[model samples]
Target: MHEDEWGEPGGGAPSEEHRDRHELSPHQGSGEQEIEASLRPRKLDDFVGQPRVREQLQLVLHGALGRGEQPDHVLFAGPPGLGKTSLAMILASELSASIRVTSGPALERPGDLAAMLSNLAPGDVLFIDEIHRMARPAEEMLYLAMEDYRVDVVVGKGPGATSIPLDIAPFTLVGATTRSGSLTGPLRDRFGFTAHMEFYDSSELSEVIRRSARILGVDLREDGAEEISRRCRGTPRIANRLLRRVRDYAEVRSDGAVTREVARAALEVYDVDELGLDRLDRAVLGALARFFNGGPVGISTLAVAVGEEQTTIEEVCEPYLVRVGMLARTPRGRVATAAAWRHLGLVPPEHAVGAGTGVVVDTEPSLFEE
Candidate 1:
């Protein structure tokens, strides 16, 4: 998160628009939105995956309801599409309250937050998506709201300023972030509960794909669902998207039924490999292996060779690769593991990383570069 003056965190919620406001990102298409919305679990009971999160959230909500008070502020941290947003919506739905949805970038000034906070109904849920990126001033405002349900709005300019204390309706704040580590110490400390969403394994992802298919009226065979699940990179959003794409392929190229082979072909056309390597993912690996001879090269150099941002390479591309054993991030730099070469359809050199060949490069590369 960039260090900037933050705005206050208050907003009005006349409707449930806040719950649906976070942008899904570049790969999220308009046509699938209806189906995606339809497929979202409305209640915690229906949510799939993240069993630990479900249990913790259930306890928090039930405890609050029993005490006849608003639930504590909740923080959900994980990569996109692991159901952080869905869980927020589910909490609101279960509580039978409306939710206001906004991202950190949307709340630019303290006044922006004050307007929203001043109008919330008691027991409402205000979800701040990508909250780690919120402006510094707004984040400061949120501290009081989360802890005390109060905000101090400064009226007038310069030396004539006056701090006006505003009492907001008791409401629940649900904050979601991909990088919880980036959150300020005070902000992170204010959360009553935090859930770390992990990637769904193949079985869970298969269940997710099958569930979406059932709702969308697609006839997906058991193995077909598994095939799609395996290539989804452990993300439900990608699994659903691939299922829709495979459904199209099935209808146009086959008998309108999703079989394992059909799923394979559809994903191949989409350029998603069995290892779930996309264009950018493969590019990072290719550059690391081919150009750098299996690496010890700096991340910046690898990003340069691939024409990508260093952060994108480190944050987005490298994590999955390292998780799946296809890449390794050494103190020296990024090294292509033996599995990476094999996945890219090349044999590992005798000098390959972890190959016990012991052929070191002329110069060891540092992560920060020269």
Candidate 2:
């Protein structure tokens, strides 16, 4: 087999030790690419959730089109699988402009970016995913292009170098980044519009599931869809994926229909619990609960215990855990809550601060009485 980006084997299961199931599908750009493309909501009208983003983007695009001017550079900042790429595609569609898809990592050098920028036709949309990862030189080149729609090409060596100013067609740059904080001030300042995508709620994710099921010809019951949505960790992509697996279970094990029981069973088989805790997620909580004893353990220590990258743990696992109140981050370190202990089938310590007196998860708190 050929070498991968990490200089490892390319044709098999990934060698990256801590790649969770959530990170596998869409993040890696492998198995779910085609399926995701099919399920993508083309127009803003067809899109679900992110009401504020949808409304603001509509106004921006309409205003630009009304004035017969190209739309300004737009930036989308959020976690993975939050429909940033889909929104970019939708932007191009609304403008009736062709889109050129590239990522920051793909644009390694000044010339690489210059080539793409110089060739763009006026009003075309250039989508750069993971814009924060772009090289310094490339980012510098982008500043001029975004402002002046021109690129300075330097030919020859040293003092003999001749700089040729090339006028590029005015194009819209649509950038998407998970780490907006990592972006330089100059780059962040370049985007005229920034859409901060939020996580989809259970209702929105349920709708996404039902719509996807209809498109994919999967017979999913309402309860089944709800089950998947609740356990999808507020992501449409995850909901769609769980539905596909549940559909397979339905076809192979029982009748060709996904019911609540079927959905539960299918998710259980894959280690996705009631609270949408996938394998890696559970591992993090389990470690915090059982191994570290509801720890104020460091993130790096936890990552080592779980065989994952510290960044992966911070970016992917910590957000959801914190959101659900399973884990708490203190100045000292990360600590598991009583809820986390109960989820992993462990009892919270009686002496644990903030855990309450004999506090039982899933049971309502009582003021008094035996």
**143-212 per-residue lDDT for model 2 (tens digits):** 9999999999889999999989999999999999877999999999989999999989999998988888
C-alpha lDDT of all candidate models, in order: 0.81, 0.81
Candidate 2: regions farther than 4 A off: 1-32, 351-353, 357-370
> Relative to the unseen true structure, what is the C-alpha lDDT of residue 76 in candidate 2, on a scale of 0 to 100?
92
TM-scores, each model vs. reference: 0.89, 0.88
Over 1-370, each residue of candidate 1 has an lDDT whose tens digit, in order, gives 0100011122332111222244555555444355556888888888888999899999999999999988889999987667888888899999999999888878889999999999998999999988988889998998998889999999999999999999999999999887788999999998999999998999998888888888889999999998898887777767776787899999999998999999999889978899778877898888888898897888878889999777777766777788898887766778898788988889998877656688654454545653
CA shift at 269, candidate 1, in angstroms?
Answer: 0.6
Please tell me which predicted candidate would have the highest TM-score against the true structure: 1
- Whole-model alpha-carbon lDDT for candidate 1: 0.81
